[model samples]
Target chain A: MSISDSTILSVQDVSISYLAHRGKVRAVSRVSFDLHQGESLALIGESGCGKSTLNLGIIRLLPKTGRIDQGKILYTTRDGRVVDVLGLSEREMREFRWAECAMVFQAALNSLNPVIRVRDMVYDTAQAHGRHDRVQIRKRMLELFRRVRLDPERVFNAYPHELSGGMRQRVLLALGVLLNPQVVILDEPTTAVDILTQRTILEVLRELRAAMGFSIIFISHDLSIAAEMADTVATMYAGEIVEIGPVEELFYRPRHAYTLGLLEAVPKLSVGAQELVSIPGSPPDLIEPPPGCKFHPRCPFVTERCRREPPPLVEEAPGHRVACFESARVLAHSQPVR
Target chain B: MEATTSPQAVQSGWAAFWKATRRALTGYTARTLLQGLLTIWAVMTFTFVLIRQMPSNPVQIEAERIVREELVSYEEAYSRAASLFDFDPNQPIIEQYVEYLAKLIRLDFGQSITSAGTPVLDQILQYLPWTVFSVGLGLLISFTIGIFVGMAMAYWRGGILDNVVTALASILFGIPNYIIALLIILILGVQLKLFSVAEALGRVDPTIEPGFTPEYIGSVLSHAILPVVTYVSATVGGWILTMKSSTIATLGEEYVTVAQARGLSQWRVLTAYVGRNAMLPLVTRLAISIGFVVGGSVIIEDIYRYRGLGKFLTTAIVARDYTSMQGVFLVIAVSVVVANMLADVLYGALDPRVRVGKEQ
Candidate 1:
């Protein structure tokens, strides 16, 4: 990738494992992806599909029990330099986190300090990175609140609990952007709010990304929403990415069987009478995964070879890849998935 | 239409208060209350029975001792024991129980046979304040230190400071309170001559009778130092450990992680989010400690020879002062109940989720 092509972050073959009762469990298995400037990459998956693990692994925010078994996470800093985030010391990580890559976690309502005012929470980011003077920080905070469409004066003194769910998410988003990080990670940020509130948060995030030109790694289970918000969509299954492509290609012309199954699972409002389909089986266990292809047990077009060997992700089109041996056969046998 | 004024609004305000109060009392069960009362009664009764069942007969022992020491004749000692303790060896069990209940109802603890004619209640009242002061102060110091240090360690987890505090706290926890007290007295009191060894009663030197003056206060405090330090050092570890563990657990909560994601500093997150939530368990633990504070100071008092209730109880046990034993037991029982009640009320006040009256 060219240095000036606005590629903000690159995750190269990242694998994370956690200490569990039954030996080591691989939570994220050899995940690799990138976040370009001003673009959102939605890591779409079920709860245990390693989407959150991958996100956490990328930021080195995994819990103490979790370890980066293998990987290199490179972040393109503001001054046009690539820094390996995983290689940074704890102190260096603390310094780099908010200033270089801020994360807005899921359940933003509870993320705020119950005792502190909203403005203080926002100002904290600026202070940690030592980016601005007190006056400048205050001005930036007010500007952020305005950008997130909240009343600066009203929310400045209000505690987290005082604000509604949407407002809290906005405040969190404001905090994330306070330091003008090159990349922002939203880990299911809108999942906890109501439908209308989720829409508002999505719009605000879109606006922020547009205005600031920060790449976003938007983690969510809702495939439709991810399709709506993401430039690139990577569907994960059992700690592995089954498919990755442009938003339209992944949603409309899903190549992988698992991706097709996911797209089919979404309740389509446009299809007036069709019964909503769901993936037949549960995700494979992480501790002792299937010997062959992890999804072969669940894949409808599971062939002998598919059951005997794992398939590698092969790029069939430009920026379109699928990890399934029977992708062509499945596509020929059935109607277009979407 | 008047938009601001509504009958429903006034009703809702009153309803909200009532709801809060009811919720505050939630989870308290009749069974729990009965169980607590029964446990207290059992403990008090067991203590009373155990003391009475001791190998030595109080009347006989006192009579023989008085005769041997030439303090009183056999007749005088026997009469004194009978009149003072109402000791009737020939009386029926039922009759004795009736007398006990009657005396209990009248709040008459009888006279201390060992202390000539001193009232048991008066004896207890005399020493209760000293025990409360020493143990209460020690507990207060430990709690304050534990909370702040625990929070510091939790905030800077995995660092050298955290490891050092954890190591020191574990060491403190491993040693016994009495051992710590003995060591302190040996080092500070006997060797350094900074404070008096044992003999920690009265206002000051008997000749001066300083009585509550600054010099007297200073002497009293100096005397109390060994016991307080020992007690705090030994026991503070548990509080620190509990607070540290709870803080660590709280830090793992979704809310705290959210706080971090919201760009809260380590300190701000520790104080506002992690520490406050973690304090719930610590508060409950402190409340429990308060309930047992009197019972817990026995070793410390014994080590320092402090004129506290523990010392009085020990003397009563040795002298076979049945009346004083009963008096001490009753006071302890009442103290525990009152402390627990205070804890319950405080818990309701601190945690909005705790409902007081709604408890079963």
Candidate 2:
């Protein structure tokens, strides 16, 4: 299982379900993955593939309808104790959250308390954790603003409405990492900002990641963004990690047909007029999913056996896993020196 | 003329002054203020015209009443009505309107035809305070209670407490204010014999002279018990339901998720993020309510037989005192328009988004 001493957080066969109107929707089914210390893991996926559900599940911030069906979110705390996070009571959970692993939400612009000043909201969080020294908090806030590449003077006193979307996103980021937590879950942080602002935010995040040394669970639908931000990449399909490997290997030599399909979908400027190949057929209804392989219905090389039995996630190479019956044959056919 | 004079400094000074003036009196603010004034004028004009158009004139109504009650011949009655009711109905409508407008400009509301020939303005001043005090206090209490309780209901939505509050508030809202008044009078005043039913009928004990003394004040409050209860029961439901729905919608907002992700306590998130944001619509509602509340006081005053502007207006209507009717309606319209203006200003103050959006 590659159980290591330096593993900061790991999801061990974690499963989550949604009590939707239609009935139980298995959002995340037996997803197992380990995040090593100081290594960013991007849970890349198409929408409704349960990337966000799994991301929220780690921090126990699942919506009222969602629940952890089974397995544990094992978080290795500062004193070397591997604590089952869900076991903590609401009080302990509150303490463990933000202090251990904070979240940078997708709705960055609206996330801030619109009525409260950015300075006060940031100050109060610092105060709640016993950073009572007002001077120190102010200093830290200015430092954070600078780190996030926001002007402290204008933004600190101004309300959320006064700031632009990019500025608000930066403020949210500053607030998230203000406590200097071990992990920050950024769920599509740059989706709302312009391209220029997105680039600037990414640069700031990279700088912060280097300086703070916190691992990131960077969740995004954009494969290119995930490729840029993460070291290890996990591609999810229909609420399961269909393929996972290092970024370079996953991008260049994907074993799963879904992953290959996604790569071909991204419009390549270098490839000239090679039309982007889009995958067809929608995701199965979670309430009444087809038996056998969930991807078989949509697979390019669907075989009888693939339709008969679900392909288990198997490690084809060291630290590289693929869940497909026809991956070996397809890999052989598609093998080319890049 | 100093043609070679430095135009830049002179023009810059003038430009800066103009800029400052424009900021102080922004186009939006000016527009809103003018709109308020226009609304008040329109309402006053409408009330004046409508009151004048009523089927029964003061002289005809008075002459009929005199003929019915006293030993007066039709000739004597007509002569008395013509002398007593000095307002000439035979005058052209335009001339009367012009005269009314001039009186309106000078804040003169003409004379009451029913009461000891008091001026309409004087009668309004006498009764307006009572209605304001009772209705205003009730609204404030209900607003505070409804806001907090409603927010709590939203926070604990789909639970037993939420259902209970929702049901109770719904009942209060559905019933008419007078019916609620009757119910309170039945239950508290008559059934339980908690408060004296007789004392609940008036603004205060007739025996006690009207003064600011403790005794008189106590009498007024006791008398107010039933009417205020009626007022609260009638209005609190709308506030609770509105605030509850607002808060629930806000709770679903992504900002709330962000607030939680920031590790704020449930209380902090609910109150600061959810409650504060939700309360904005209510603030404007409350302000507009404050203005329209004088109108709301009409039925409640009639129910209690309290000597408020509402009761006085009712009496004036029954007596066909068109002057008093026009006067009271004018007051109501003015108050409502002014209240709306206050609400808009308050909105701009509380929400910078509103202010900044307009400026840009």
Candidate 3:
């Protein structure tokens, strides 16, 4: 609600859409969030929930068909200068990207150019931002690689295919922070690796964030990861942020039915022998979604008014917001699992 | 203990040698080389047997021609034809095969049958350079231009460039090289009056002496224009289409997006990321095309009356010059085989994924 001086990236009424054959599919609609300096925000949602689109929209790396329909992505530079990312010229945007804000994409296995060596990619990223000193870049890269637990020299010289899935992810993470970007957007960084490797990546990410002090906005379907890595968590459903707050506040005192459904769907360790409750029906079609509340067809607390009108996002608690008419009832019904 | 160990050491040494030899024989490069060599030999033998079985023997065909043209007696024509040609029609096929095989081992193609004592190797060497220069230049020009045009088309897909070039490339790709050459001659030479067909015939003008002089080079290029144009029109289509699809696929690759997200210059991403990867699949295709450069375009060269290796081949086949045909076939087979081997090596060098015997 209130923007502080430390707020690095603020997405105000952002909307993204893909021009499809049938019609324009609104992928992300009016998604607003503030990512403060050194704070990690995780956008949690099911598949096709536009979690990835919002993050990609911030960096302006959407596919050809995908476009930012409306939004003001305000990025604060280190000098406290507010620059509209949408307003930056192509040339300025190129310099702004990776230098000001970098994104570690999904599918780490395919993230790197297979033909190129890691060191060349490192130099390329640095040189693109006008950092021409090779020795300094190399030294910084080697340090980052070491911090990520990779054999610095070996990984530096090796091709993308030469490294394992986890290694590539780490290399990408290290590369993502190489430019010392104030904001790093990670989209499902741990999805393609094994469990142990996932743990390592998380630890490395934490260490990097701690050491470098950069704000992170990560997209994850894994609730545990969202719980562990995120300082602030935003629950996205049907292209809209339904609930968002402090990690503990959102997870424990979920004020939206969709968020409650998500938390209940996950099989809890403490609550043994309980049946996992999956939300009935699939996600609504974006082209011609149901009128009024998009979640009403699937929401348990759907009232007569729900089908006729959409609920505006309102603050249910200090620094916590939810978009539901029956937020108090939903919060009262939510039982703490841990 | 020393005596016992000595015998064991000798056995191990022999085992190690055998292992090394087996490894060399079965390794990727060695296997590819061996297969290529075998393929060449197979093609050579097939062509040798096949060309011989075509219609009539050189001596008999020549004798018939002499009798019909000069109104000579059959016996006189036969004797003259037999004497004129270095071929002995009475010689057993088995004996001829054995002799040919023996000479082939020594890398000697023997004398030309039609030209009598002229060495087949010398004739081929004289004609080879013109073909290589013309065809090689055509391919280089087409490939380079196609790559840029194709990438541009892909980048601006659905735009006017993509739509126009796609249709044009498809149409050009469908037409045969010889037909294209004839069309160039008909449309450009006769209808359009772009260049005189008579002047364009052969590799160079008779007055232009062989040198690195501007006049000589100019004359050579002028003569080469028709065949080179034909080659470019016919093959550029294939390159453009191939490169377009490859660029499209490479553009969709995650690395390309990542490269952009890294704030890389558009040129760097296009070259190092998109262009390099897109060009990989085409590299082998290009290498194979290079192999055919040695063979030259027989029909296209003949149509243009260009004195390249292909024209030489047409002459040899017309005269039933067995030795000359065999010599040309051998050269073609060797070049193709060598080019394939080079493709494998070059592919390995360009792409580290297929680099043989490297750490896995």
Candidate 4:
């Protein structure tokens, strides 16, 4: 509803599903969000919560089984033209990808062709978009590689197998923004690397974001990473946004039982050795989910109303939304400040 | 000078020399080549010993044939056979082996027992080129067609192309080369009257000079068509199936998806990403196949009446000409060994992860 001139990507009521032998698996159900220019929005959730599926839907790069059943992904081009990505023809979509929006995949190690040199892949990306200036592409790629803190020349000429995991991740990140796209979607960029490498990647990402000024849709299960990298956080439960707000507000004053439970589950450094409370039971099956509020089965503050009816996403504050019947109770228990 | 150079120093120098020699002998490429040569020798020796163990020697076999057909006495038949043959049947087997080994060391295959004064090496050389031409052409055509069709099948997997080709390729793969040759001759040549079977016999037209002229080349190709078709039909299915599976696996790789996500053209993705990666495992297979080109298909060549190395091998075996058979077998053994070495080297070149002599 908060559509503005600054908004780069407006995803409206996006619902995606995957066809299976049993039935259709509703991966993401009527999800909606706005990503403003230069803003980093993190979609945080447990595995199989449709975080990745939703992002894949945005690029229209879903698997053969997956379909964006309903949604309009309105993208604002640099020339001030708004294009519905879903309506773009195959040729136009090919042109739009990486030139307007790029995705840095989860498996960074396997995201590059092993037989090909890094420079060739860069050339390939450029050539695909009708950019034939190899010298210009190389110079720009080398510069981007340097920004990502890689040995630019070595990495540029080297094959993917020659580079380490962290280096490959950085190479992919550099390659992602080589076209200077308006949006970059990163799906767990640091998951494959060591802790030190993860720290380096985060730093490099922050620096790159500051320099390039592109909006980001960061998907991760690591709350700490989400907190560090995201300006706004959206907690997903059973393929729906259970709670979404500014990072600080969501961390401090969570208005959803699932959000509060997720925070409680994470081991706090300050409260060393305190028994970490965990949310009981697994995520509900999207194929045939439990009726009413999907989280009610595992929610601590479950009520009769919560089980009987699914709560719609409603604004609890000026900028915060929660889909829980017991928002007031969750908000009260969320504060750790004594 | 002796005082300055201590005994320990001289000893150490000799030790270093020996260490260098040891390293050279044990190095990967050197080791591989040595193993290949040893394999060739072993196969040659085994064939040599095995063929002599056959029921009849060349002299006795020839004599019996003469006696059966000409109504001559056994003593008269034996004298006639002895006079016709260049080989000495009375020589001890051990002495013959030693003489063969000695001549082989100098690359001499000796004279053919059945073919009077013709050297086995000369006859092999004459017949080898025809087999190479036919089999090589077949393999090349088969490989190319298989790669494209297989890749196409994989890219559009589960489609009509996929379903039909999968069934067809599997069927073709199961059929033997000789059977395919017979089928071609029977169905196309004899039954269909597509081409005259008599004209297809032999490697080239007797009237045409074996040169690069259009007429000569045309005749050569015309003659080679039947045998080549047989080779392609027999082997193409294997290549197609292998490439299809390889390409399918490659298409599933994350990098392929990433390549498409990068907005690469479908053609580019097919060739550079999917095709190149998929073709990696096939390079070794192709090299091994190339090795077998020299050995050729004996039955297929015989059926087509193509005068190839395989045909020569068949005739030598029939005549009980040990020297000629040994020569042909040696060529096959050498080619197979060399091809295996090429496979290893080719694989290293294609896949940088397994590049030779780099990893400890």
Candidate 5:
């Protein structure tokens, strides 16, 4: 570990499962990661790879059927004390949820109140946390609108239905950081917006993170955007972290075959290609995952040892970890850089 | 797109509207108006046959009873019974039916032989207002209480308040309306000494003279209270249960969850998003309830001895008075049809999704 600073939020060995109709579906299995102060960590995975489920579990917002089979999520509160989030009662959770940690959901347009104006929605969070007076709250809202590069007069008085998708997202971003919480979770915030809007929103997020100094948990399946935005990256497969390291290290020197396949699958703009390269085969079923290492059947470098036992996540270098027995061989076999 | 003012476009738009209307009406062909009318005709015909098939012919019973009760001669009694019942035993069944259809077309329901020669239509018109007042008032009260209480229960889901309200609704819903009415009569009328348990006709006491006065109006209202309460208590549970379930389902929608995640207060989310959407299903149920209210309660009216249409129907059945029975049936049929039509119009007004004037 680099030991830059203490982890602001630590999730230890979190495992969640849901009692589905067929059987128990393991959503998140022993997923562990830490979010440091003022740094962004991206959880990248395909659908059903447990990225969203892990986020829900961390916030204790999982649905009725889902249960945290094993895990502990510890957060450093504003009072300079760490507490387990799962231990709090529902009422206490409500009090701590938006005040200490807020979340920006994926569908921002539908997330806002259609009946009330944007000003009321933002003011509601401020009032809930008792953060500021009416005048102060309005002033802060205007400042946030300007910071997000939205017109305060036009948007503050408009209902959610009246605003476009990008504008609504900006409003949601404003609401999320209104209380200036220590941590904010952005769950695929840019998925529904256009490409230019996505870049603008990401830029705004970077600016906000710099000025506000709040750590971010950016959850997305788009690895390219994640690489561009995240400092640290965790790649998940079948509800388990196959690799985790600094973004640059993971991108330049990925050791796991699955990680390498994911990186190669991203279509490069500079390369002239008639078609994009896609990873063959689908994700493993979580209800009854493949025996031993779940990715063995999908891996091109599968061996008898890889099929017999799962490889634990071992550190291959400083801040670089890979969960594959042939990591050294895979790195040795790659072509030299130009 | 360019605005089209061509004749062809206008014709096509009209054609589309008519097609949509026809599709909506005939898509459910078995439940269409023609099918419903046929069913009504069959039921009325069966009722007519059943009444005539009863032992003790109306003409003979009336003649014999008049002779025995009034000590009149057979000849005089026979003439009086024939004139009152509009009957000649010599007439054939086919002829009678033809006359019946003709009279029906003319809106002539004949006279009530059992009610001392009163016209059957007049009797129905006389009792119509009392039924409307009592049942309509009861429905209003029940709906007001049911919707609000159900909303409250849904808001505090799984709490003690929800459990208690649900339990109460279940108990009330399980009990029959007559049983409820009887229980109320015993409690409020016999024990508490409040409000009259009987005398549910004419709006005011005939003994007080037929002019509007504060005392008369007060007595009329007081007389109406027991029946209204009884009817409301019997029917309110169903509305509450329905509204509660609908509200809970609405609360589970993605929109409601999104609203809450947007940092809306519990009340704002409940009222604006959950309540508004939940009310759509409740509005349809309420429309059905309104239709039933005009038809009146058959059991509750009987228990309270209220001379509403339901009570009159029962009396007609027992007396074997065919004219009076037919009259009561027609009144109820018309009332139900009109009530349902009114509900459909109101539904269209309330829900913008329902398009009106697309059908003749």
Candidate 6:
């Protein structure tokens, strides 16, 4: 199970805390994962479940009050040097950010500089990182537009608002992979797009990622999309990754009680809902999460052990990891939902 | 719809010429210009009617002057007064208004009834630029400084610098410009003796010949300093607070985050992304602010004893200078309309989103 040939980065016990008005809210707690080169890791969870935080945290794009409270983010450079992302100076981080890893932000189509042309927005990002050869940049930009199945001339000169949501999402995709980065973190890139546009974005991203051979941290709340797009799936609850495994292993043989409850909650196609079980409560109170297993209060199979102490994420199968005390009992009793 | 994109079609220059002409005639620029002209005409017409209704003592003043100095009979004085305005006392107010409009079209604001024989147009020309110079310079200083300070405050939102700036903005907004002008004169003119209460009064010193010399220009600027400072200080707070709040909102936008994530330097992100977006509303406001330069700082001019249009307006009212009042009001109204039009056109150059070619 050790990372080999494609290992690009490892998020080791990285905890992130945000200074909200109410109090300190731990958005991501001691989350750990290995991101293999050219592999896609789908970070799936309900809303406010730290999936987005993990993406932002990996790129060091946390807001003004958000801080990495503990642990190292060991990022593998293009040249295969492992540098602690947290330990690097801001200046060094700047060089490493887009050149090595970039993110296609969530609901970002509307956020395109409404005043700037699509081409200029991409150029600005390219030029900001000291790429001065305009002709080369333009040539590459046109090529990228083509790769995304967009005509550069038709859309390039037009301001962002002039384009449809689908076109705008493609532009964002182009910008994210502009430098052919080794790693791409997509935070809900399909959140605001129509279904047709979502399929197009997925196709373009899959094609581009295949051609470039880049690792991706795909963060989404939709379990169906994650099941389809990601190689490995990490289920997050109450700011912690409660279960991590290959998509099939997690979906079919969910060992964690939260994962079992989550899989059961999703409505399957070609079938009518008889009793589609739902998670009992909303996402845990971030400011004052329940003690021990943060999910214990809302957990369906809550035992005394779950309320007393937090269970460590331990490997239950060859490639599956779970953090529930009753994972074994739940896995035996819970039927496969998908 | 500009659907033709074939390179050969554009090679002849005919298509280009046609497009350019079409854009000018049927696009946003032409539409906005029409709107601006309509607005200005409406303002001029409204002011024309309103000024005539204002209480005027000009006929009384002229009649009294004839009786006291010329030793004329009261009846003779009355006839002389009635004839001077070219209006019959028995005619309706609307009839007088129509007559006034006819003369206004001919560019004849009849000679000031109270001042006798001096043209209202000439007096307006003499005082208008002084007000423009003071108010325009004041607006420029305040807008630039306020925007910069506001941006910095937003960047350092919770810091001590932000608190200090917020407090200062509150003080500026709370106090009126005239009060600030009074304080400046009372303190700087009376106590500190930084500038003379007398020297800083009027457009220029009485002794200097009104010529295009360095000395005359220097004297004119010295007179403007106090009023300009007061106007800028009083108005700057709103600009700062608006810009700060707008920038704060912009900083949280997903684009800003995406911009930063793309490895842009913090400075580049701040100016090109965050600052540019935050400034769109302020750009329109800047145009409005410049328009007010023509409005003049009436109370500030009064406090400083400066001879600008605002002061001229006050004098015209007291002496019942009807033509002069009408002339000044028309100028202010026209300038404000023109300023708004300029802003609408400027939007084409500033924000690309609004530069949409033709109306749907």
Per-residue lDDT tens digits of candidate 4, residues B241-299? 99999999999999998898899988899899999999999989999999999886788
Q: Pick the candidate with the highest TM-score.
A: 3
Candidate DockQ values, in order, are 0.26, 0.56, 0.88, 0.80, 0.17, 0.60
In model 1, which runs have C-alpha deviations exceeding 4 angstroms? Answer: A1-4, A113-120, A131-155, A162-167, A333-338, B1-133, B140-241, B259-276, B287-295, B298-304, B313-360
| Poorly placed runs, candidate 6 (over 4 Å) | A1-5, A270-273, A335-338, B1-37, B63-92, B106-110, B356-360
lDDT string for model 5 (B256-288, tens) is 665555445567667777787677777777776
Who is ahead in lDDT, 2 or 3? 3
Report, to 2 decimal places, the DockQ of model 5.
Answer: 0.17
What TM-score applies to chain A of candidate 2? 0.96
RMSD of 5: 8.4
Error of 6 at A315 (Å): 1.0
* Most DockQ-accurate candidate: 3
Real A-B contacts recovered, model 2: 0.50
Native-referenced DockQ of model 1:
0.26
- Which model, 1 or 5, shows the larger TM-score? 1
Interface RMSD of each: 3.5, 1.5, 0.6, 0.7, 4.2, 1.3
Candidate 4, DockQ score (0 to 1): 0.80
DockQ of candidate 3 against the true complex = 0.88
Better of 2 and 4 by lDDT: 4
Pick by lDDT: 3 or 5, better one: 3
Give the per-residue lDDT digits (tens) of candidate 2, residues B1-360: 477566877999999999988876666767778787788788878877887788878778888889999979978897788788657768887887788789888888887766647898988898888899889989998999889989989888899989998999998899989888777778887889987777679888899887899999999898777777788889999999999999988988887876776667878777788888999999999999999877887877887788888999888887678778888898898889889888888887877767644545
Model 2 residue A283 CA deviation in Å:
1.4
Task: Put the candidates in DockQ order, highest first.
Answer: 3, 4, 6, 2, 1, 5
Model 6, B219-298: lDDT tens per residue? 88887788888988998999999999999999988888888888889998888899998998899999977778877577
Q: Alpha-carbon error at A289 in model 3, in Å? A: 1.8
